[model samples]
Target chain A: MSVVSAEALRERPVEAVPEDAHDDGLAPRAKFLPSLGAVYRAQLSRARVARIPLLFVATFQSIGIMILMRGVVDQGGREAQAVVAGSAVLVVAFVALNLLAQYFGQLRAAGGLDHYATLPVPPASVVLGAAGAYASFTVPGTVVTAVVGCAMFDLPLTHLWVLAAVIPLAGAALSGLGAALGLLAPRPELATLLGQLGMSAALLLGVLPADRMPEFVQYARDLLPSTYGVEAFARTFGDHPDWATVLLDLGVCAGVGVASLAVATWAYRRAAVR
Target chain B: MCAVRGLSKTYPAARGRRGAPGTPAVRATDDVRLDIRRGEIFGLLGPNGAGKSTLVRQLTGLMRPDSGSVEILGHDIVRYPERAARILAYLGQESTALDELTVSLAAETTGRLRGLSLKDARAERDDVLEELGLTALAARPLKKLSGGQRRLACFAAALVGRRPLLVLDEPTTGMDPVARRAVWAAVDRRRAERGATVLLVTHNVIEAETVLDRVAVLDQGRVIACDSPAGLKERVAGEVRVELVWREKAPMELSEVARLRERAVESGRRWSLRLAPDEARSAVAAVTGGPAFDFLDDFTLATPSLEDVYLALGGSRSGVKGLVKA
Candidate 1:
């Protein structure tokens, strides 16, 4: 119960060394997936307190948007399907792209890259683990939005299960983008600004119908990673779903996810070395 | 064990035109060489901007040196910095990455990252928390703890899964005397029982003199002195410090007062003088035992300390007097 003094420890006889000593044949390097799992669990626990409340906010924001859009589209046409799907995927963009960018930007600006760099964990694990954790937060919000949107748009509920594929794919792509934006930006404020801009792009380009937009606008929509995710989900609302087109859109999302995550990992290394 | 050879790191000057000469580059570290033996507690002492942090960063492999190599247990850490995490446990000067995690989770997570098994990590977390007297605050978030308590939590995390070397930068900065004592006790125990080498960088010379087995003093990016505290203090052992506090305004016309004013430092009514032991003896006896005694409020003579050695080595700060000159 009492605090032990340095003099007290000095007076005691030296005890035998324990076996699991820090120097006993240097600690083996922690493998990738295991350490990634550890980082993921840590991020999950760390975000558990603040993020759950924001998750509700993100869900409500998407649900609120759908209610506003319901006034103009009287018929359950392609516009309604686009509006519903885009609103659903917007939830993914809010957390995975917007919040994650803010998290990483703050992390990097605060010299947090050095924190993880000092650890034996791989750079890829940090990037992938954090992206995965943020993406994981999108699941409930995305599912809720999609179910609510499908019912409101008078779309078939049978194919909503495709979200099992959509959330992870879109989540990965947007999470990677968010992580990169935050890590690459020189300042935390810039990172937050970039994240908001990306979410705005997701809202405008993704939530709106592509066929109604001008040629140049449609081109810009193709460049937006979340647009593919929205399109994939929207295709499922038709009388007969086009699995081929949906898979192509999903393939592009997965490709962008891979590329964005690689860039985030590269940015992590660049920031750490300084 | 850690070996640093020909280590030199110079930060480039930030401004210059293409053809014109640039601003002078700040030499953060210059031609430094060191061999830290296992089981010894080595201190790195210097004034502010004395390149202590730059040296520590290079040693920990967070920053690559401009030239030279750092080897820890035969691994060239400069080339393979990823291995550094396994070889060294670092308690940084300002760590906020784990502020969101609770004290216990911080320790447990650090243990896991350091490759401890889940059960072992928990067990070590418990042991370290108990040893640091942090068991009571283990559930508290780091941000919610006082500065000293949060620092203790970070230290506990560093100790969770040990590496061969401990690179602690001001580990006891905000700690109370008792907590500081505990920190040193834990470090000293680890070195004694497990032969861990410690590279402690601090401005607390008083504590360093007591806890350090050997110390290196850096000035302007150069290692001006490297020796045991007693060995370094031996350089000034022949000297004594004479401190006096006058009751009122200094009698400048008095020969003794004039003599004291010439070389001594003045702070209000107090004056401190450092001199050869024989000279100090004569000055103290004359000032305190003679007519000058009437003007004196207090006076004392003391032997030189490690702090005096630091001051004598051209470090960019004046000596810090032990008393408040009251």
Candidate 2:
């Protein structure tokens, strides 16, 4: 069939008019800020719910370990000293479980990144909101760990305020690290592998005594952020608090937390643009 | 309103042995220009690998063009992406809603992000869900819905924001015909009531034809044609098809019959002809005097369609060429 040009159609506008054309008299500018907040809350809620089961299991496990350590201390053995050592083990185990849960959640939630990027809001806000939701997930487990450690280890309950401040900071730092990893890992398999490797490294470096390992391994352990976290957490649960060491560890945790958040934001922006 | 001027994109070869040391880059969009007017359903038609999605991404501010400018509603997509985003909603080819979230939550969240109050967001959510015929499935998790239903849920999320511009990339890819029609109807309503401009990227020509005010056909990263569908169909002049059946068995060696048929077709008498205004009179005269054609039965005249124009413009060739001729 022969086709007409736009010039021809323009001359015969009445016959060539599109069937669906219409003129609506509404202004184009409409505020959409409410929907932006709604999208953020929806993403945050999904992250929170998905990690609940893992948080519950990890909390129960920490409580069980604290109870076992308390029983050993009550028996009046050298194992009483092992209680503080066991607390370090519990910290590593809890953080690892939290990281694993977050990594998988992020891998599953990758599709949402594209959706969020397409929105009018800054990509950084979405990343921060998702990280904030993840931090919320770790709160329940962190509180349980601190509470159980103090009750079972005869920790100085008089300084309870310190535990309150330290636990949340440490939890936020760990969650931030998990978010950064989730953003960087190229695929689900890589995320799983890195999560497992991180857990194993944290267990060996933070839980096991550094002096027992080879000189090179000891040096490597000192470089890990979890080593400082475990150290600070152990001091919080001990009878005598070393304020200087605790302050140093807290600084390290805060630094890592900021860095992790920065990395996550950068990754999110890059993903959005590409 | 969105405009892309001198927009271009190139993908580099993968690293290592597969990559040549100094190979030329693969250009995706080559200095293409477009203007999508406000409140119009501008269809972007192209086959696979024709860079339609890439252009959509650039227009939506998801991907930056290698070099060029994309302005949406007078806001430059790259320079003022945040501002542009407030007025635009993008429904990508892939479903972006979380599977764990219920359909209602998804809608509510999208509304909230667009800055609606909690109560107002919920009210809007209810209205959108009902309007999209998704109220029955609103309580279900996204994973539970069928593919078509899931797409509808995403569509509802995009519409919740009530943005002035909507950019959809293959929005009806997996939808059934009924679902596709429903989306088209919603789009129509949005344009009529809200004055929302739409940029739809799709390979579904027939579906696109139903809503597009004008279409731009892309091939190999260049727009080959841009006009109203009827306008495009008029470009292929002198082409016609004639069907004839005889009462007796077909005659053998009827040179006269073949000659007359050829002359009639050349003169615009066969099937649907595209004769120039001057040629039409003479062509009609020649066909009337032909002896092989005593009385033509069931003859119809029609103009070429967008599909025909698509084939004629080197649709099978390699390098990009546009029909808009400057």
Candidate 3:
């Protein structure tokens, strides 16, 4: 009864997956998107019950930062506009990314993946369902933060309708990144630390006026997914916004959202099987 | 019905604190093979680290085997995990409930995941909770439940949809006798009403002995034996145990008692003598009808049982300790 190590097994290449693996005749299999609505509803209810308070905190924290920035920046300028919009989008990142990291991390640490793993639902639905739920929590907070920040900075409130699009776009990018970090981290404590650090990084890079940053720091800001979202919303506050540039920024946000969420789904699949 | 062939899985060796690795790799499951027939309660019996959970995981498609094939109802599960999942329901070794969810919510969500409509899922969840006598605790959050209560809640969730195949890993762990019996009754009902196949993994051999139509005994990632409870007990047949107690004033010296140990395994007042099937009556008569018959307080004959076969098949303390080391 001597046991052989996995390393020994790894020396041999894996057997090719058989074509029969994809056969549907064995049992009545669920479609890839089957019960997505049910999954989404369950996740949303769980988030509403457990995460609403945190959403409020994220909103207040963003507004408080905007009020603080009002003292340094003059009213009705591009700097003020960036401060207002950046702080608002920052709320979405806070809950969607930071909180989600902790949620999935704790889920993995607690053996919660087994619950989803044995279910007939596709892996993508689990990731997307959770991410969508966490992202939804950002909407009320993001909207409240935007309105309060605009009032404090004396920016035009007329263009506030843009937040409807901005909240979801920013939420998708940040929530996906958050879910990936949580699922990938080996330890729950490490995931929490990474989540907090990620939020702080977003605050430092996304909230500050880009003109004042060093050339290299500005490049780092551009690398962040939330920066394009903030820039897209910030441009909308102007008298004559550049529709082309705004669409480009939002498109970048949407593209990064898809990529990050895809990675998160991949991470979930990897963690679940192990 | 399910069949597993050539199932094997190896996990990377864990490094010691000093950084030296013990085994190059640990075979969690080693060339194991098994078949679970329809409408039978099949038991996977083993000590800790004996690959019971590993085998269950492989069958459920939660983990892929390094080398093996799992076919459910003649469909290869490895190639068609989703299809396998459709007919099979798994209650893993770990509790699978979201702490934020209430007991009913968790059960309802599970039913929904199993493809019930919202209304039907809710109805099924309520029915299951009530059937399991957990209706009182249905509104409580999972985090607020005791360990046994949580286990029962998750067990109810698993039973909600009643798929054809049910694989439960240590389902009765940490449960009170009442709750344990409730789960057993539920399992029995599933088998009786639906002809559902149940593959149960458990350390409670005595409890399993009553329900298992067939069982496989695993040791150190290998299936050392597989048979019905009676069939396995029959393997160690012809052996009989006689329990006796001496009269308070009997003339048996310590040395004489030591000599008696040569033929019998003694425990306190009980002497388990190994007598052949034909010799049992005469041996009992000789011990109870001889000169010491008047000095004997009591005597009884005990037949060989599955527990005896289990221990005789190297499922002793040291054997399990070796498995733990691996």
Scoring each candidate complex against the real one, what DockQ results?
0.41, 0.20, 0.21
| B176-202: candidate 1 lDDT, tens digit per residue | 877887798788767776677899997
Query: Candidate 2 lDDT, tens digit per residue, B1-326?
Result: 67889999887765555565655567778788998897788888777778888888777776778899987656677775555556678887666445667899988776666655678768988988887788999988787789988988888888885677888877876778777766887787666555767888877766655678888888878887888766666676545333343334223245544443443322123333344545554444444445434544333334454544675665643221222111
Candidate 3 lDDT by residue in tens digits, B40-134:
88998888878898888888877889998999888787876656567778887666346677888889878777766678778989888986899
TM-score of 3: 0.83
Sort all candidates by DockQ, best to worst.
1, 3, 2
Better of 2 and 3 by TM-score: 3
Instruction: Give the range of the ten consecutive residues with the poorest summed lDDT in model 1 chain B.
Output: B317-326
TM-score for each of the candidates:
0.89, 0.73, 0.83
lDDT score for residue A260 of model 3: 90
Candidate 1: regions farther than 4 A off:
A1-24, B16-24, B243-262, B265-272, B281-300, B318-326
Compared with the true structure, what per-residue lDDT tens digits does model 3 show for residues A1-274? 1122355336633333312223432323334565666667777877877788888888889988987888899988999989888898888888888998998898898878887788777878888888888888788888888888887878888878977778788888889999999999999998899989889988999888999999999998989999989999999999998979988988888898999999999999899776
Q: TM-score winner among the candidates?
A: 1
- Taken over the whole model, the C-alpha lDDT of each candidate is 0.84, 0.63, 0.79
Native-referenced DockQ of model 3:
0.21
Write candidate 2's Cα lDDT for A132-198 as tens digits: 5555455556555665665566554455465454554554565566666666677766666666666
Kindly indicate the candidate among 2 and 3 with the higher lDDT: 3
